[model samples]
Target: MCDHHHLRSPAPVGIVDHVSSLSENFAELVETEDYADITFIVDGARFRSHKVILAARSEFFRALLYGGMKESQPGTTEIELQDTPSVAFSALLKYIYTGRMNLVEIQEENLLDILSLSHRFGFVELESSISDYLKAILNIRNVCHIYDLANIYSLTSLCNVCKDYMDRHAQEVLTCDSFLSLSQTSMRDLIARDSFCAPEIEIFRAVSNWAEHNKGQDPTPILEVVRLQLMGMHELLHVVRDTGLVSSDAILDAIRIQTESRDMDLKYRGYQVLEENIATTRLGASVIRGEMKTALLDGDTQNYDLDRGFTRHPIDDNSGHGIVIKLGKPYIINTVKLLLWDKDMRSYSYYIEVSMDDKDYERVIDHTGYLCRSWQKLHFPARVVRYVKVVGTHNTVNRVFHLVSFECFFTTRLFHLDRGLVVPTENVATDKNSALVIEGVSRTRNALINGNTHNYDWDSGYTCHQLGSGAICIQLAQPYVLSTMRLLLWDCDDRSYNFYIEVSTDQQKWVLVVDRRQESCKSWQTFAFDPLPVTFIRIVGTHNTANEVFHCVHFESPADTSVGSLINSVATVSVTSGPPNSPRPAQAQQGPAYPLITVDRGPSLSRSSSSSTSSRSESHQSVATATRVHFPQYYGPPPPPPSAQQQQQPLLPQPPPPQGLPSLHLGHYAGHMLQQQDVPEADRMDIH
Candidate 1:
């Protein structure tokens, strides 16, 4: 009896292995079609399936087979599906049994049909899998078609994915034939998005072209959504006026809004909300130049007036004469926002490259063949980069490349650009109230940092205090090396405010970093100062032109610990090591050591007092143990003499000119502004 009971049971199988085998068994059951109790005739093809399996897997099937539906009645096993394709129903049946479908094996057109059928059959898991697969294959050609399908099916996730892809590649997508072929509903949803970064005029052209292609289709509903108030007066008269798509009355109203000072819509500039721009002055971002530097990261992108931004000549040359942005430290960046000089209708062609070590660079975007204008929001494959260089290959206006503002970021969000600019949410002061201690006597302190830019008016969307009542103070969560600040003064009416800002590490002993008590300020105000350790900021309003109240809509300080270096307009830079026995400066030792690149920017772009002067630290006292370096100024060769034949030649069609090629004409009045500054020999010393 003892010998008969000694045999051991087989070793227990793992749960994963058991489940895999179970799935395989179920899959075999689907192929064998044993004990088939139901049949579906789809597009004239018969499919045998089981009633118990179908009822358990899908609610739609359960209702049709077991519920009070007619298909559940006696002798109703064979049901003909008029709308579904045989191939799509075949795939659906397999997925219902095995819980897996090979999307790669199905054609895209057939897969789209499967997606529709999955929605009808209530196969949510199968629908989601197909939607994700569509996003992976999205391109300029198929994005519009997919977007239309998403809209029709009310697939919110798929619609959002398609919309974001369209917005990121708006300029390219706008030109595709599929864009013109989109349904009116999809077209309305597209142009209505604020995140679409193309110029308002370009959107008008695209819509007008779409309307022309789809004749007999009433475009009144679609045309009503084109945000015509955002278009310029010049575009209204020159481009949109003759289109005949917009009614005469609508055109007049848009033109009137542009001229009226009371309309707030005129001030609404399109900005990307998808990602925060980390390439900022407060984050140690700078436009590195060989000689005289420019304030390309000052956070003031609206001003494209001469002397407001920077320009480089012979950008098409191989000498690497273009814009270089140092992002303070290594950042996982994939997007770059470039505000090209758009005061004119000129377009530019360019390429972008990034580097981690500043030596080995990788080219990411190359639009050197096509023309791009206004706001250029470029996205590339994500990579770790510390340096980004934008090289202009061609300019329709001239040979020189004019860039008003530059920004870079690691965009992870898929939201619309609802805010005033592309300032990162983390860097914005109002994102976390608990982390910041805000103190002030106002209508609502929350309104000041609510991140709402377009909904504000005289009575709402702002924090207000009677003049001289008390200063609005904010205590940061931690100390940061600060240098830049951005604020929006309530501009509902023709009112102005005179205010001053002070920063401090502790509650006591404040330092007046910005003083503007004498001059009037309105709209968006951005200022910068020498970097310092700061945790507290106080805004004191001295007077207001409108009654006795001071109002502020938004305030932000984009500060990071890695922001001690100089990023303002730089004229000269020298990085030298201190004597071996010399002690490092306390400020330098606290964080990363950054070379102070100081320049004489003449007038204060900070809008501070005229008496204020740029502060420069002595080179000897600020130097750390580093090699001394000098960036020499570059003056490009002169352009060739005018010729009738050269004037007729297209700029982009020809092969790139040789290195040291002369720059083309830079307009009549821009010659002096684009000239390279002459650095004195004494200031060009290199010490090691």
Candidate 2:
């Protein structure tokens, strides 16, 4: 009786969540727009909001609601916000009352508006929350669009996010659909960055293609951003002869510089690798067509196919029709180099079949569905064959297959397993090759693999939301024996993080290998894991000392033994940070330092002999490449491959074209992803 008494403890008031229930009720009432004290008229859509709640959530709202304005005294009020859109204010109201939002539910086209309006209304916290949401969803297709909005609004935090996205994905961003419409200023900013990862030719092709795509538009204006002087003589002459993309003046200047290579300041020797071309030799051989017209290759070398005026030539639209190039007595072809029309301007579908007898063909590379225009170096394992067949299948515009040049390059390495690997989500920092290290430069994606240790003051590292807990998954083209894993966190020799390394053969069942939870993180460290065969490795995060956010600049692993023991170099990016939470890890307990290496400049890939703890200038440059990456964890299987002879049709109905950019546009896309489906679902499996 004594135990049962005590008046039921006054009904335990703590059992009721006032704020939580209020939030839920507010959210439920959002759409009905019922009992709303204030109606915000945005782009003709009325958003009903409560005055007290709005004032409490935002200073701007407080000023308007109760700061003696006409809106504050209103009995029936409708605030006309023509400059803003409904998608934005709808989200803003929900967030103001509930302090939360589901970014996925918001249409991406409206994300910018939400962010802009957040800033405009002095919802500093909400604005930042929106920015973080954008950062977490960054991708090649949307990064440029997001940047445009971020730049227009001076969202400093978001600007950093865009720069980082471009740092690691410059090539893709430059060739992407959004890139064609990028303002000249945006394009110029990209070209000027030292973090631009691809060769000069990539830029040239993109610019030329953009000009062609928007035919009435003069692409020459964009040429001002092109640094033709950076191209080597061989590369320059080839571009001029093959593409006709460069002007006469630029070509002449490049020619003069190349002709005087002996006296020029540029040294052909000691040239750093830019991770562009694969490490394959262009086996100097002759190619002839089945019709025996020499297949447009008069000299069997680059730019020898036809004059620039020819533009493109398509193979006869018949199943057995193709361009056959005989490689002497069939040396194993490791790589096939195809210089197509600009990647954005045109896309071709083709089958790369190798035949011992020209009649019987075995498909070696079935690029039957992809639409690519830039230099495509396809890597397959060493296959000994006599005839290399380039068969056209389909194209985006149905134009004739435009072939500038097709060359077969051979190497001991057949597998280009890591070519187009992509991080599954924006939660992780995708890898990069080169990164800008200038002080005060915001963090860019280059930090992910820039071969540079992160500097807190410079923010030269990948950062995630303050409260987010996610994994960084690195998808591999083929399974490799795990060797060494390196992580160079932002800010050298300080800071701590709680994380673990995991592996998955099938992105479904993940295995935990390296567990370093609650351990003081290190700057420039390496850990050698026992050899394990795995297709993907995810670095799972627990926490970081910088309680504000979880960040890392570099995450790398050595290429499989097939790439051979490689060399590494190092660069530094500086950032200023308050004192980290705890004592730094003892130097003796830290892993070995990672020296950055820029691969694929030729077999003679070189690196700085010693790891420097010093800073590097704009002169410092490096690039890296990854292939065959994928994560099917929560995502559906990639689109199916096309049949050999089936006229390739659109995989999915082409989405209605994007609406033109909006002023105060929030590029926060929530619609379906505009992915290329580059790596098919079958190929993404363990190669073993």
Candidate 3:
């Protein structure tokens, strides 16, 4: 009453006067509760007045306060409100000033003092903010309390978030006593949900290492955790196979958990699980039968004579060609085993025979022995034979050569070998030069023969021609050191002739390496020559009147020289380093040929003379003297005349004689040894 009129002097009649005037007018307009069409100015914009009024509600105010406070200072503690009674007022003020609620501050125990205020005052935003902030900070140590709170409040998202965080940092948080006390369901849920995210190998290693260290400790908890997380029995077995973590105690604990659980579905799964997890070991068994494909029955009960034993089954009578085993094909036979039942009375022999094209037969294995009273395993190296037949030669009076069991095993995993050389069956044709169409052999005319004459026609289609009492020769384009030679004749047998091999660095100089006459005229056989290096090779047929009608020719490196050189060189070097009494290493030491050297020296020097006079005289002397003294004489064998049967065939066109060219002989001639005339004048250089 004292000067109240002065305080309300026309509402101060300035900017405040206008504001007050507008407020009064708004109050009058809203007095009828008719807020139908009204406008109000807020922060720089005009809005419906009803909207502004609705925004002042407790819920909206709370949201505004929280948003504003978060924007102002992210990740900082929010301001605390007073008592529950003042919470609404605080929320209202925050909404009016910042349009958001700051209820995240309620995470503090002290802030919980006003939690009910937000719930009762219709501040839903503020309530939710409090729950979210709690979830972000909850951990294993406080998880129990948080869980109870979440359950009471029905906060499912918050509960899941807390569980997830605890599981991710389990090693760090599980040390807490409270975490260990979690209900089994809670622990199971946590592990099952998070296991997929765990590093599988690392977890396995850690669990294994932990169980190994704590051998005698109770493993129930660890086992329960793993059982809940393991997806299947196969997964468990894989883990065990790789990590070897599940100890006996751990396995028992897992079994107990499964038994106690009401999950009947896991029973069958568990049985298979344990069976697959058992450790496994491996053993191997094999059989051998030389080149034969037949299995051994029993040699223990009967005495057998291998050479005298022969079994014959005609191709027409052999109904089980499909069942018959093959050597070096479907299976390889290397060793044979025979089971013996009695020793004193049983003696037997075994024999194997193979036929070419089911016609002519050859024996591969022939052995005679008495059966001992023990199971015997025998080894046999593969020989060159095809069709195989096994027979028992002798039988005891009581036991009649009975066989218990038989099996054939192979060691050659890949590739199959035929009876003879494997060559294409078709595509054979004579060349324009009249050379015979040897199915798989290739030759060029650039090779040398007996003399400096390049008149050899490798492509000539001639089958067998009579040379005027001279040797039949063929040459190669490049010189090759051959150790073995095999020839297949078309109409004549290779074994009928006395054959000799001659090689020459220069066609004029020949060295005979093999001089042997055949006693039998077999269809095919290999002739091994002493290993030597030469440019030209000539085959001279000395005996038997049959013309040479070769259809196939093959050359191979010498086994003794080629393989021996490598092993011998190593042996020699080793022997040189040891004492002289050390058995001389059992082999000669050979090495690669000497390397060529280039120099600007003026004149050409003969290698023979220089090497003899050089510091390596001892080494050169042995090689040189051996070459000179051991040289074999070369006399071209008299050629065979055309047989009467060959003359009966119709005559064919004859090919022209092969052309001749100046032969170039470059043997052991080093580049540095050549004279200026040998090389072009433009390429010469002077020594310093």
Q: Rank the candidates by lDDT, best first.
A: 1, 2, 3
Local accuracy of candidate 3 as per-residue lDDT tens digits, 1-688: 1242345646533545444344444444343435533333323333332434444565443453444645224443233333433434434333433344455543454344333444545666766776677776676567655654554455687766776565556555444555444444454455444222344334444445545555665444654555432344455556654555456555545556655653322211010111110111111121232222123322222443432221222222333221122333111243333343232334344444443233344454443332222233333443222234444444433423433333333233232222211121211111211111111111222121111111222222112211223343443322334555443222111113345657664456788875644432222234555555443455554443222222222222222232221111100111122322232222322321122222121111112211111221111111211111110111123224335574343222223211111011110011101122332333222111
Candidate 2 residues lying further than 4 Å off, grouped into runs, are: 1-18, 28-35, 65-76, 211-222, 232-251, 259-688
Candidate 2 residue-wise lDDT at 133: 86
Q: Which stretches of candidate 1 lie above 4 Å from their native place? A: 1-16, 212-217, 229-243, 261-273, 276-688
Candidate 1 structure, TM-score to reference: 0.44
Task: Give the runs in model 3 whose Cα sits over 4 Å from its true position.
Answer: 1-107, 111-122, 135-144, 177-253, 256-688
**What's the C-alpha lDDT at position 317 in model 2?**
49
> How many clashes in each candidate?
3, 27, 30
What digit string (tens of lDDT, one per residue) describes model 2 on residues 340-387? Answer: 544333446667787655666667676553434445556665554567
User: How many backbone clashes are present in model 3?
Assistant: 30
With candidate 1 superimposed using the best TM-score fit, by how many Å does residue 454's alpha carbon deviate from the native?
46
Residue 69 of model 1: what lDDT? 84
Residues 330-419, model 1: lDDT tens digits: 556667877767664466777878875566567877666445555666566566567888888877767777777788876775422211
Worst 10 residues of 1 by lDDT: 667-676
